[model samples]
Target: MTGSDPKADLHRYLQVARAAMLWKLDGLSEYDSRRPLTPTGTNLLGLVKHLASVELGYFGETFGRPSDEPLPWFEDDAEPDADLWATAAESREQIIDLYHRAWAHSDATVEALALDAPGRVPHWPAPRNEVTLHQILVHMIAETHRHAGHADIVRELIDGAAGLRKDNDNMAPGDQERWRNHRDRLERVAQEAGRSAAVLPS
Candidate 1:
């Protein structure tokens, strides 16, 4: 199928992205999953960990899906972005399974609830609270895609693998090496311009 129904497209895109992220992590040793991809320490598996928590919030907690399991890694008191990293205690398999389980729960919620169903974001400021499931679905789709992009880069860093599924041959035709070169050139141009002053101070 070229395109899909609105909700189905949005949901399936997210699901496929999530699956791609997991697939990239496949065959990686535990040590590799925790290795930072950049100066700031963004790891492939940690992104999955973060997304699992996010799915729980947007789909599970938002619609009252009854997520009874204690999320120790999701402690609100933790320092900012702490949840974005994996702990020594967390194995690659465990985090991956948790994300798959999160997907299962989230899909169930998305299916059972209507788009217009009312939901509350406890984290949202109390003065003006509550939003529809539709809003969260949109937000989650954006969030998942954003993280999924991160996963792509991390995967490339892992083994020179690229694209959402260039390996699958379902999308447009293009050479991976040429794509990388083009993206690199664009980045250089952008960075050079970005650091320059407003007047292009030569």
Candidate 2:
């Protein structure tokens, strides 16, 4: 494919990641949206909260432009991993709104600074704390997409629905029965391999 503008490209990918993440909550009840589907308590709303914090830090504070919002999760006495999930009192709308606001703030930072503009990550280790806007952009894009992947799995577990995104699922076309047969074949192969390995020398 032909190449386009760099900043536009980065922002486009970032938006895709963001939309994928938010789409995971579609058609889910409030309870399901916040449900922790993983052993480590990786929930949909929490993922949004975590990414919002990440965007605030990497794009805002790292560039010496702090957000006007207060993140109590980052406070000194806040419990560890507070940003990773929302509390019972927190509503889905509130967290989602905050995440959207973070996007706006982050976009402003990207617009104001050149990609090569100098920045500092105070939370990072001393030796590697210094960074450029381009580096931060790359880092945030990776970070956002990683969580989007997590959301994909978690969303599947909550319901049977799974895909890359709403408009473009990017999944192999197959009916439910076909998919089940495919999975069963893979499981049988795995079991056979396991049995074979079990009898081999330690």
Candidate 3:
């Protein structure tokens, strides 16, 4: 394991995050996948759409290998946060397909470039915008996992499903009744702590 190639390691982690992102949509209905679960309209499919755009921008445009795909939502006159969601016209399958294509394109960029290969982020501030393939890979891994975390919560809210991945849930061992009891205990603890603080010296 210690002899593993650095680039391969980074790419593997990026792929893991990508898989987790898509796995979140498994068995979800179109409505459940698209429905806004958060105050800011975060949804499972929206997360997929947003990450696809992120990968394209970071890996494609930054590397001077731009994608031919038309992304009107990113145009100057487009609505705010247009990339953060899909329209009714954009079917779930379509968005997921786009995401898969984006992954292929990004992977090509990764394969063609060395870790230190230079690229520039046109949208980032000057000087700071200059970056290497290594930097982009690290940045993207964090970005994808961050959104995957959001999907985890959103998916759980829509149904009772929750986990790090389909293979390993990474949750405490418990039945629903046990889980409910655990939550109740935490609530009681919180309430007790709140009262204790309220009675503390001013």
Candidate 4:
């Protein structure tokens, strides 16, 4: 490999970000990680479960090498948000282990396939025909990060531990007061938008 191979560079950045996302859950108690953070039951452990399925599908099935393991849910018919919470019989450790394993297998595909390597996303509405490893990678990055956010909030609520990474390397750069003000501003904006939407003419 060259001293700074562009291919390796991109992959490394993606891998780093992916690891940071998972690391956000480190050291948390099982109950806390699996606790329903919202009324719809979006829990950290459940996100991990959903991610495992996504990675397996995008990387494995896309290549005509779908996994043989029994999917955690939606095997036949899926509830609207069945993938957003843990099943009564599923332990936190099992879900987490499966997610990590999915990462290993999915990343191996990333290494084996080229950015333009063709994949078929049978579920897409229009392009229901084809895709590529690059597009899938980007989609996965977004999905993982979205769920990692769920993990972040849940973790913080559990033990006041909040960060996008285990080492807090990706956290804010300023004082706590400034951060609070920023968050408050965001909250106010959201509230205002909600109120405005509610009051709009029918």
Candidate achieving the largest TM-score: 3
User: Which is the winner by lDDT between candidate 3 and candidate 4?
Assistant: 3
Model 4 per-residue lDDT tens digits across residues 41-135: 77777777788877888889887767665774756577676766777688877887787788788878888888889989877776655887878
Q: RMSD per prediction, one decimal?
A: 4.0, 1.3, 0.9, 4.4
Model 2, residue 156: distance off in Å is: 0.5
Candidate 2 residue-wise lDDT at 66: 96
Model 2, span 109-201: residue lDDT tens: 999999899999988998789999888889989999999999999998888799999999999999889889999999999999999999999
What ordering of candidates by lDDT runs from best to worst? 3, 2, 1, 4
TM-score of each: 0.79, 0.96, 0.98, 0.77
Shift of residue 152 alpha carbon in model 1, Å: 1.4
What lDDT does the true structure give each of the candidates? 0.80, 0.92, 0.93, 0.75
Runs of candidate 1 with Cα error greater than 4 angstroms are 1-5, 126-128, 166-202
Q: Per the 3 Å backbone cut-off, how many clashing residue pairs does candidate 4 have?
A: 0
The global Cα lDDT (0 to 1) of model 2 is 0.92
- Supply candidate 2's per-residue lDDT for 201: 94
lDDT of 1 by residue, 1-202 (tens): 5755666766887777787778778777888878898998989888988988888887877778857655677697777776688888888888888888888888888888877899888888865458887788788878877887787788778876666663583445668887778889999999888777556746
1 or 2, greater by TM-score: 2
Top lDDT prediction, candidate number = 3
Q: Report the Cα lDDT for candidate 4.
A: 0.75
